[model samples]
Target: MTRSLKKGPFVDYHLLKKVRSSDVLNKRIIKTWSRRSMIIPEMIGFTFAVHNGKNFIPVFVTENMVGHKLGEFSPTRVFKGHSGDKNSKNLKGSKNVVRKK
Candidate 1:
């Protein structure tokens, strides 16, 4: 049986369903950030929002360190070169994703 959309614009109905159940969508978001060469499994955060459109609603969010970087930007933010601060050392001595309480 096909899944049903809860409510929203028709265009977003499709997109939201794709976002909700598609590993491909999730991986694409992750890879886009990774391609920009950001650190991961760090102190980045997650957020979700419901976008109501003319036709349907879409669930939108950000994930990983990329989210933190995006959030750090200010309207007057200026870009200097990367700090060259590779926190990769944090990965040493620990498993990739440690389940915390």
Candidate 2:
């Protein structure tokens, strides 16, 4: 469910303070664990270190990222592709196999 429009976007109070104090010219990374916080217009041009479960992943905010959750940019899970079957390896080593249309 989306947040109530009347209440406005949920930008963390502490994070907001950090954004306010940070200088856009310096390009400093503002580390934050507020994954639930929404990205606001003021956050554009600033780099944020959003915490995943294990570590902090850097996310540079841009106008296109506005209205999205901070967590959306920092993925929590690692994708290790599907495992190949035992026969798949043998098939790869054999180049003489022929295919019919």
Candidate 3:
């Protein structure tokens, strides 16, 4: 769900304060766990280390990312394989010629 239009985008209070105080050119790398926070226009060109459960993922903000959640850029789950069980047989149909009696 999106935030209320009247309240505006929901940005982290601490993150907003830091962004406001620092110079645009000397952008401070921000590490945050608040993935629900929205990317504001002021955040463009800034680098953010967004937490994705295990580690922090570096994200460089751009104009295109505005109004989106910081979490959208960070991935939580990783899909390694389609196999359901490790101990289960992977091959359904295969030749067993070597076992011929």
Worst 10 residues of 1 by lDDT: 30-39
Shift in Å, residue 29, candidate 3: 1.5
Rank ordering of all candidates by lDDT, starting from the highest = 2, 3, 1
| Local error of candidate 3 at residue 59 (angstroms) | 0.3
Kindly report which residue stretches of model 1 are placed more than 4 angstroms away from their true locations once superposed: 1-11, 24-26, 29-60, 63-101
TM-score of 2: 0.84
- Model 2 alpha-carbon miss at residue 16, Å: 0.4
Tens digits of per-residue lDDT, candidate 2, 22-64, equal 9999999999999999999999999999999899999999999
What's the TM for model 1?
A: 0.18
Residue by residue across 5-35, what tens digits does model 1's lDDT show? Answer: 4641122233344344555334343212111
Against the true structure, what is each candidate's TM-score? 0.18, 0.84, 0.77
**Candidate 1 local distance difference test against the native:** 0.32
Clashes of each: 6, 0, 0
